[model samples]
Target: MDLASEEDKEITIGAFNGWDESYAAAYNTKYALEQDGFTVAVESFDAGPAFTAVSQGDIDFIMDGWLPVTHEDYIQQFGDDMEAQGCWYIDAKNTIAVNEDSPAQSMADLADMADEYGSTIYGIEAGAGLTRMMQDNMIPTYGLEDWDFKISSTPAMLAQLASSTDAGENIVVTLWRPHWAYDAFPVRDLEDPEGAMGAGEVVYNFSYAGFTEDHPQVSQLLKNLVISDEDLASMENIMFSDDHYGGEDPDGAVAEWVEENDSFVSDWKAGALAG
Candidate 1:
């Protein structure tokens, strides 16, 4: 396939709302696509609607899907109209994290230390799969039925996390790996001895039906994409940092990341075009 001869060069990428990894991947992929002389637009939606839009061909692809567990319901509903482009990131896991110095080290310990941690478990959107797992599995299994499971937006939860941690107060909040928080905050995941949180999952790129056939080069790019934890973290750290978050130059951040990983970018582009 000649990159310059592609007919469908304009693309729409979907991302989940308030998901750092989602936007990080979307913008990064946007940068790559733009570099290849393709026009890209990224739109954000909650998980459910994002899946629906992609299945209906409203968007071309999304890069922040967690497989085998987190996003299982959406997949079951829309899998027939979507293509799994393969995992770009492995070791993805939903977690309930607490301050690093907190005495409670596991979900089992949260029940007893409820008062110390304010008898609350902060969480992201109520509809999120992470929230569902906590409500249905982790909370009950760990005897935290009476505890406050506060449902709110991811930013709100993170704000609370920031305030609590800054005060040296104990706090617990729902979080996930492949996230910038682990690097920016003084927090750690609580052990789930009973496996209520499920095993680690892989992050996949999904496209609408026939997306591959429509844009073979982009499909090849998706297939060839694989980001290491270290690189992803670095990019996200820059992306979500105070200077870049909601800043005027969002693309500049991605450009900076790309400049830093020029060799990887070159190899990735070459591999995709070679197909």
Candidate 2:
């Protein structure tokens, strides 16, 4: 039985993308939820497929719902059919990461470095909110019609980023904060001249309709959950380092960290148990 069905049942939780940090974090949360008397089965899918699954009630929830803007279109399409469980992180921002070797320190710099950058701006998942925002807004706002913006899946885009960054070549790609990539890479967000990408973001936990009634306890846990930037940064730091703080698995390390930091964990989970 899925966590949602068990008397102390295991719930099937899933992520939007396989490579996202949320996959590891979900396992950490799963461990804590189990310790609190629940079971969890975690899984992952690319953005489009994940939305379809969640909308069709195939998955319980996704913790990486970047919102009220970035994933706005997805939510609009799926909102009536899904329940937004809670907000997890606030004041998030999307970034434009460029190779450290590039002389481009800002969006304007990219204009001059276009030749060096191969006249391209790489982005993740063509239909993704960020990519669409860049295509429909940022490019036009900044007059980047001449530049080719490449759209590939998250892993492919990041893999290319890693390769380009490693080679100290000039490359620009969509990036975001409160994500491991920000910590792992020596990159900077290109300065935006038009501000079309916006400046703030928040992470939300979302589920399909009727989920609250089906899994009241888990819903309560999710509704009561909130984490600060500092807490998230610390968690991200630990999971990204050594390939293993609790072993080779980032999820295991996060689980151990949460267990050890009872006080902090309590702030996010224990509250649900209280009221």
Candidate 3:
């Protein structure tokens, strides 16, 4: 009889970097997989590339698919080639946040007073699903053609938010819920009356076909995974904190978080095995 291949004990996980919760979840899941005597390889890419990687069988799966709005097209595109293991987080919000004191309280307001924000809307990675929706749907739907959409990385946008908010100046940027930025800065999400940027979505664990049958235990654990907004934000904040990991070594940070929440981690793994 042939011995089991070493590849059977290994799993590759793809993740996107611009979003903190994506990294946090990917790292957390990686740790859990390691505990089960499996080697997990995590590769980071922009949202578009990440989806392409999974669909093309370049990576086993990714844990950051926001659905019903943000990544709906991706799901339609990939079709039966990929499948969702489970939904772990709900109402995954996309936002246009501004300083709490800013005059603009809604997307409509932003269209009128673009000068207050320097005629530019700070944005995250251009390949992000959120960025795409904003460009293709929101901008045209809301008549926001005048505002310059500054497509950049998340950190750069956060830096601009920090600089402007610190000086009591107004700034608006594309942001998301369950992110550390909500805790680190005094900002509020703008109202989108037109629902152009999509509505509340759920974050999902998506994998290539037959991933579950090949790696049942690991797949089950991910499918049984459930996380709340408070706990998620706390974990993400730890990963983002300078005093925690200093923005480096996400695995170390995840290990620390796992240790602190031993009961939660224990329950997660045990529940998976039991079910």
Candidate 4:
């Protein structure tokens, strides 16, 4: 029975909290692995640490790499040891959004209308890649020299959006796709013609080299899990609903999402088996 190198029956999935898309994918996949009899260990970290952990094989894999821009530097640094997998969610991206009623329709318009938005651009965590990109690229490229890019956590930023939106005030913040806020509020992304933030992002499942060869079944399932914004948002809505989590405990939201999307989950599992 011990003829070969001991195979790890347990797989650890690394993720970062506050980022809804990342959290959703990793949490849901953890449940899926459990269904396949794999003891799933979950770990949480900031984006940078998560990248390094996966690179050193300290963490098995991550399901929320926003590629082609966000996480590019991290991949360049540690990606030699990483196997970037499928683009599970293609519309993943970051943007500056204002109330749907705001007059500024694009990044170009933000500079002139900064006063209208209270001369402030509320942003997520200071360490976020999106924040870096906005600070380093978007503001300068858009001629928003007079505006303030306020650094705050995602939850805080969302709260700001809530208060601003409730009073029908014009407010802009750094937001991304695959978030529950789209359903919870009326906001739209400001068009970026200069491509300061690069093209729309695609969230990828990243594993260490030889992951497929070592764990073929689970690898295939993660690779085959292609979901749209609506599907993911629906999952977030249920899993993160106050009635579910904040009202009590986590309440097995991912499993509930899987059960609701039994057809999709079944197809992915079948593909893995066949692969």
Instruction: State which candidate has the highest lDDT.
Output: 1
- In order, what lDDT does every prediction score? 0.85, 0.72, 0.82, 0.79
For 1-275, candidate 1 gives per-residue lDDT tens digits of 35566788899999998777888888988987887789999998999999999999999999988888879999999999999876788879888899999999988998889789889999999898889999999999999999999999888998898889999999999998888777677998899999999899889999999998898888888887787766777788778866355433558888988887787667776664223
Each candidate: RMSD: 3.8, 5.6, 5.2, 4.8
Better lDDT candidate (1, 3): 1
What is the lDDT for 200 in model 3? 88
Tell me model 3's lDDT, rounded to 2 decimals: 0.82
Q: What is the C-alpha local distance difference test score of candidate 1?
A: 0.85
Q: Candidate 4 lDDT, tens digit per residue, 1-275?
A: 12123266788988876666677777777776666566887787898999888888888899888778778998899889999767688787777888999999999998778679988999999888889998899999998878888998987998899889999999989988878777677888889999997678788899988887887767777877887766787777676755445312232777777777777666665654223
For model 2, what is the error of residue 138's alpha carbon versus the real structure, in angstroms, after optimal superposition?
3.2
Ranking by TM-score: 1, 4, 3, 2
Query: TM-score for every candidate vs. truth?
Result: 0.79, 0.66, 0.73, 0.78
lDDT of 3 by residue, 1-275 (tens): 01122248777888886678888889898887777667888899988888888988889999999888778888888857887888888858877899999999789887788778888889999898789988998788878898889999987998999899999998989988878777677888899998977778889999988887776767777877888766687788788865467568988888888888887677786664223
lDDT of 4 at 232: 81
Model 3: CA > 4 A from native? 1-8, 46-58, 69-74, 100-105, 108-153, 168-170, 241-247, 270-275
The reply for model 1, stretches above 4 Å from the true place, is 1-7, 46-49, 56-58, 111-120, 125-129, 145-152, 241-243, 247-249, 260-262, 270-275
